[model samples]
Target chain A: MLKNFADKPLVIGVTALNAIDSPGPGVAVIRALRDGFGDNIRVIGLSYESLEPGVYLHDLVDKTYQIPYPSAGAHALVDRLQYIHGIEHLDVIIPNFDAELYNFIKVSAQLRIMGIHTFLPTHEQLDARDKMNLSKFGEKYKLHVPEAITIYKADELRKAADELDYPLVVKGKYYEAFVCQTLEQAHKAFYQLSAKWGTPIIVQKFMKGTEINIAALGDGEGDCISIIPMRKLYITDKGKAWAGITIEDADLLDLARQFTKATNWRGGFELEIMRDADGKLFIMEVNPRFPAWIYLTAGAGQNQPEALVKLAMGEKVEAFSEYQVGKMFIRYAWDHITDVSEFQQLSAFGEL
Target chain B: MKLKKNIATSENGFIFNPSTGDSFSSNGIAAEILGLMKLGRSADDIKQHILNTYDVEPSQLDRDWEDWSMQLKDANLTEL
Candidate 1:
């Protein structure tokens, strides 16, 4: 059982504080955590870059510390967390970046031994949902997924494109995807994406449909605690949702339940789904963490982050049955002005 | 020949299809037609109501009625 936080607030550490054009879930997750716990939680911002907006958002984050990149390996990551835990006595740590989750999950046991708890998916669950293995996962679970061909060289793009046919999607192993209507466009995307995200470019069959997303949380025992389905009203050039509304769709909710049951998912996750003209649902991508729009789950009355914290603390949480439908979230940007001294303090001392 | 059972419409011409999570805004006439449909009115009754309320000719209403029904079908708002 977890200790009562009546005297001292629950100090939670969060990573991926970047709230740029392609926003990270950190800032939004922090907002949801505040909404959930009220004044009973203290947020410690774990940042990778000095310019991450959450570092300077003193209202949201009590203090900020710069963590090493994931390439520095799990040992370096655990060392930094140990230092942070020594000061903040972090009760829970939520790593929000796709690139950083592997390192975090790798060191979760060690962190637990040091008194910092985390609710994250197991390594096998993470590996199964990886983009490279999504097709196999879909096949094993009988889910509809777009066919994809993973290739290592640029010359292989033509063959993969031919197999999938024209108007395919060229995607990097990790990020960046472009829809190519011709072989020339495919070749160009191949070179650009491979140069940036490295080898094993994925050529997926373009499945045209209306896009829908679901933000869900599972209780690590194959039980879905909360599920909120949303449809994008407006999209940005980068394909991120600018405006979205909570929707009432049983099928979407059932899909999330099926995923949680199959994977026994233990944490927050996002499902990028596509509904075809005939109303067939296709699982396009499975994000292993909370989406940037996760704050909507709290607005819709689920408070998933709070539930996740409870689960991490070994508390039993009941599954949330209903959420307010038509609750909409419209994202807007405001320039957060801060002096260079704050940046210098964080950059020079690695803490602010 | 009626709107879906769970489809909700507001007085301000907003339509919400709960089944598909698609929302749409309609003009005054279209909203009136949807309101009538929500009341379990048949197609003929909807047309008659439109004729009684608006100053549209029967031939023009017939032409536009087909187009309007097609629009509802395309939007997946109607249970045909």
Candidate 2:
């Protein structure tokens, strides 16, 4: 019978790119795993690129290694596994970024075959990551999501403008947002965005009010162990929260629960939401991986990253978290600059 | 500036003002500071008291107090 990992098992966190970026979910997961689990966990942070200056890999992990981006997909990842296994037998692999999550899912079955446990869900979890898919799921779950219409060609956006309200949002099928002030602006935005980002451009009704995020980790058994709901007090150029505060919104928590339950989701996830003028909440997007602001919640008593690592090790953890309200999270400029462009680009192609 | 007399706070972290009905919650420190504000203390007085009582630095206390006071003002928590 499969058993929970023995104590102090080797845990490796795999990332596809830069490691120095702060205010990222990966950084929080690393810290929480080390802080919460302590000597019981041996962390190894692996990336596809060199370590950023001023970052001490040894400080965060027992070891650090780099692997080439999986150009050949499965084969490249398998080679990385071989390399990792050679150094120290890894018991679990945690994919931190969206790109790495995609790669991890592609090779998930193979990893399980090798006695390596990965908390990654199947392709069904991919639906939650795609903005369009989550919007559809929202309807079935009775949760309100942004009114968005997807179009293929730039001219098709004219129909979106005619059908939707003014000040519509012009976004790619995956990620990337541009505001359209008029129908003509929508068309221009569609073309420019499509030319730069390719396919399924979406126009969503603009929601004016507070932006909020709900993050959680689940056991794949209809039980969520941790939930952190935050309201965006300050948003950056990339729409990342530069400053945010923990909030107690029971309705928002219910929405998150309904959405996750509808998907039968397991593992760590984040939901981007906004409250309209009437106080009605609508989901903006769903991220399958942890958000860059996970640590803000960590300090507030919901250590989701730690929960994920623990769950992956087959440990029995609490089924729910009672989060503290009134805590604040502030993201520095450097953290915002480090990965915004690249992450946005990858999001455009649905590659992340 | 005159201080507003209406003050509201709940043990569960809920705060609502009968004057504006604007609601909010605060962390331990923010809650403490706002609680003091309910006693009708001036901003400078509150700052001085917090600095003297807490191990926090003067600048940090001033900045946090200023931000908190501004938020209260935005919510119309201050006097007319």
Candidate 3:
């Protein structure tokens, strides 16, 4: 470590590099960080799979390390992280995967001992937005949420199906959803998704309406740093936004601020919203981390991830007051051809 | 088993089936298997070749082959 430096470079670790059909926010977050700090920061890419392209993007990620999958449990994760920290000496880690956030939060204190910082919502704040607790959260915070219930068993789905009208959504606890208009479709989707993502699937009232999304950042002290709302212009089969345009809506901003104030939420969050025919916004799901569309925040003016870094560093950052609306983002696939030996190396050695 | 005809596959592992108009991406090994399948290699031949080329044991390779074949069947890229 350098003794007397006016400004030492910041080394930040980021996860969630899977940007395929079901996108993750790591690429977007890294882009936002690059936009903010440029050459002043070194990005340490943390990946679960060997093929996450972010690991190979030399311009974006300064270094990459393959970490144990979250299913490997906390001990293995911490060991790998400890080894990586010994080498890279990260100043902060921004975990972008929903499955991995809990593990990061658990080890945050250990990380702090190593001089690494992370700004994240408390465990209670995270629990409040869970699929099982969505209704409770909305009820407690005076927000509108569609009727939903988590089914612990397949038989429970039948009961939920009887209550929620036909064409209701059968959703896994974490990911995957299907709209079932009949008992047969409901049962099939329930069984299939349960096999994939596990039990306790959510049976939600499927509202026929426009889907809107808000990506916002909240300080731990009941203050929202930035809020950017977008409406999907084009959606793929995976339900991801291929093209979206930012919109200026005070009501949406107010909802974000109110929610953050209610939960005292810290860090980046994306609120999945459904707007009905009457223009009423209902919160569908509250993602605890930044959304895959988070890069749009950087383009619009407020680099939320950069602000999050400052907050994590214990530096005070003022809330962003202005943004350029109507800015659009259209996602595309770009292919990078590497040698077969490169693939062999990464798969065999666990690093690129 | 045979790979679907008119399936456009690139070296970078992007696969586009012109018939079904469905596109998918494969990993390096999957791409190699698909390429070999496109060349009309039999499953046993490909399995033997992989066994010789990679360090995986036969039983593990067999299991992986079965799973990969199932995935290819699900994707409608293979006809058995």
Number of the top candidate by DockQ?
1
Per-residue lDDT of A124 in model 1: 97
Tens-digit lDDT track of model 1 for A10-104? 99999878998889999999999999889999999999999998899999999999999999999999999899899999999999988899999
Model 1 scores what on Cα lDDT? 0.91
DockQ of each: 0.61, 0.06, 0.01
Judged by DockQ cut-offs, the docking class of candidate 1 is medium
DockQ, ranked from best to worst: 1, 2, 3
In model 3, the Cα lDDT at residue A232 comes to 80
**Looking at model 1 chain A, which ten-residue stretch has the lowest summed lDDT?**
A1-10
Model 1 spans with C-alpha error above 4 angstroms: none
Candidate 2: clashing pairs of residues: A24-A292, A25-A292
Chain A TM-score for each of the predictions: 0.98, 0.84, 0.96
Per-residue CA lDDT of candidate 3, range A197-269, in tens?
8888899999877778899999988999999888887888867889887776678889999999999999999
Q: Give the per-residue lDDT of model 2 (tens digit) for A325-351.
A: 777777653432345554443335322
- The regions of model 2 sitting more than 4 angstroms off are A1-9, A16-24, A51-57, A68-71, A183-197, A333-352, B1-80
The ten-residue window of minimal lDDT in model 3 chain A covers A1-10
* Full-model lDDT for every candidate: 0.91, 0.69, 0.86
Return the clash pairs for model 1, or none.
none
* Per-candidate clash tally: 0, 2, 0
What TM-score fits each model? Answer: 0.97, 0.74, 0.79
